[model samples]
Target: MATIPAKYFIALVPEGKIQEEATALKEEMKNLFNLKYALKSPAHITIKMPFEWNENKEDKLIYKLQKFLAGIGVFDLKFRDFDRFGRRVIFVDVLPSATLQSLQESLGKFCKLELNLINELSDRAFHPHLTISFKDVKPKNFDLYWKHIQSKHFNADYQVRDVALLKRMEGRWKVIHRFPLTEA
Candidate 1:
């Protein structure tokens, strides 16, 4: 059987206040980029890029992730402004704080322990953005999407209790397990 690749991502999903604002932005995306390509609810700040793995190997991957995360603890994240990449994507920009940076660093080390030490590029240094839009978007709709998102600013703060192991199943992504960060 053809298998899907899995990834490990740590994120702070908008809980109370941020969820409300993200909902509104999602609605706007429905009109702007078309709902099919945009990400679903519970918008968040990603800690690591999606890691690739096969379904048959998922069990080992999960165990590796669990052990790696055991040494780390929870952290806080703050969301700030709406920004777009060219005209294809929209997101909530996170004010890169020292705490967030440290979390990313720690997660990177954990990933290296679990998997191969992939070369992380300088430009790919975690900037901490909450995705709000996506690809296959039209140029004409950029202004319309921007107007709807410009005035909307969400500064919701949330705690990062866990990291998720996600797989691209069917035609979309789904979480296989969420590993809580705990004391080593």
Candidate 2:
């Protein structure tokens, strides 16, 4: 018998007002533009890109992540308006914070050294943003959507107290574990 590998990623899932605002924006994208793929998962900033591993080794991976997060402290995050990667994707802009950058870098190093998961995408550079809509937005509609929401305003500030381990199951990504940042 063969085992199927499971996919996982680490992310900061927004809470309270930030989550609500991001959810509302996703709803607007669905209703107005008929784009909804980003809604498949909750709003978050990807600290580590998706990586695959055997199901049997999941416990070890989780243990490593817990240890890594235990050394991190809660950090403040702020979002404002909208931004995009060319015309292909649109997202809520996350202001660059040294704390966020440092956390991402440390996660990349830890994943490589501890889990043997070397994520080139996350390792190369990190552009932290909360996606609003992508993958489903057609090229023709990209401009129209971008233009319509370009100037729309949204502001949210929240503390990232924990990191979530989301696993792809049956095709949907769901939060399987949460490791809180414990250090001051």
Candidate 3:
């Protein structure tokens, strides 16, 4: 018998009202732009790009992440304004912070060295944004979508105290585990 592979990614997810607001924005994108892809996953800022792993080794991944997160301290993150990656994607902009960058870089390196995992986006520069929609955006509607979102200001900040591990199942991403960030 052969085991099926599992897909996973790590991210920082906001809680309380911030999460509610982000989800509302995503819903608006779906209703206004007819883009449903963004609704598949909860609002989040990606810390690690999606990667594949053996199902049988899932416990090992969780164990290492637990240890790794024990050393990570809480950091403040702010999402302010709207931005796009070219014409295909729209997202809420995350203010640049050294703490966020260091955490991402450290997590990336740790994944590569300790877990022997290499993500597809690992080579590219990390641009952390909570996506509203991606390639599903129609070319003709790009401007309308951007203009609509850009005109409407969005700003929120929250302390990031945990990183979530999401797994894909039934065509939706589910938060399967959360690793608590140690107090600074």
Candidate 4:
């Protein structure tokens, strides 16, 4: 018998008004550009890129995350406008904040030390943004979509109180566990 691998990533999910606006933008993008891939998951700023592990090891991984997050304090996250990774991708830009950067660094270290997961991309540096369209975007339509949204305005501010563990099941990613950051 073959066993399935468990895929997971850590992210800060936007809430309240921010979430609503993000969702609306995603819908518009899907309709206008036929970019349905972006709708697979809720809007979120990724803290750690996706990694695979044995399904049996999930409990241990979550335990380590809970302990690590317990000592952190909540901070603010703000999104000002839209940006892109060249022409292939478009995303909501997250303004740089010291607190958010520190949290990401701390999480990366903890994952390396405790979970034994060395995320090379996150370790080198952090570029925090919420993706609106990716992967399935066609090169032929990239310029058209990019030009339409490049100067569009979007703004939202929300508290970064919890980091969620999203797992891929079937073909879509879903939030399986959420670890709240407490005032420490």
Clashes by residue pair, model 3: none
Q: lDDT for model 2, on a 0 to 1 scale?
A: 0.87
TM-score of each: 0.79, 0.94, 0.95, 0.92
Model 2 spans with C-alpha error above 4 angstroms = none
Give candidate 1's TM-score.
Answer: 0.79
Of 2 and 3, the candidate ranking higher by lDDT: 2
Over 40-103, each residue of candidate 2 has an lDDT whose tens digit, in order, gives 8989999889999788878888888898888788889889889998878899999989999999
User: Can you write out model 4's per-residue Cα lDDT over 68-182, one digit (the tens) per residue?
Assistant: 8888888987888998887677899999999988888888888788888886865556889988899888888898888878757898877888999999988888899999888
Instruction: Note the clash tally of each candidate.
Output: 1, 0, 0, 0
After superposition on all CA atoms, how large is the RMSD of candidate 2?
1.6
- Model 3 scores a C-alpha lDDT of 0.87
Once superposed on the true structure, which residue ranges of model 4 sit more than 4 Å away at CA? Answer: 1-4
Model 1: weakest 10-residue lDDT segment is: 6-15
lDDT of 1 by residue, 71-110 (tens): 7777766677777778877788876688668767876876
Model 1, position 125: C-alpha lDDT score: 65
Which one wins by lDDT: 1 or 2? 2
Clashing pairs in 4: none
Clash count for candidate 3 is: 0
The residue-by-residue lDDT of candidate 3 on 20-61, one tens digit each, is 888888889888768889888889998888888887888888
Q: Order candidates by lDDT, high to low.
A: 2, 3, 4, 1
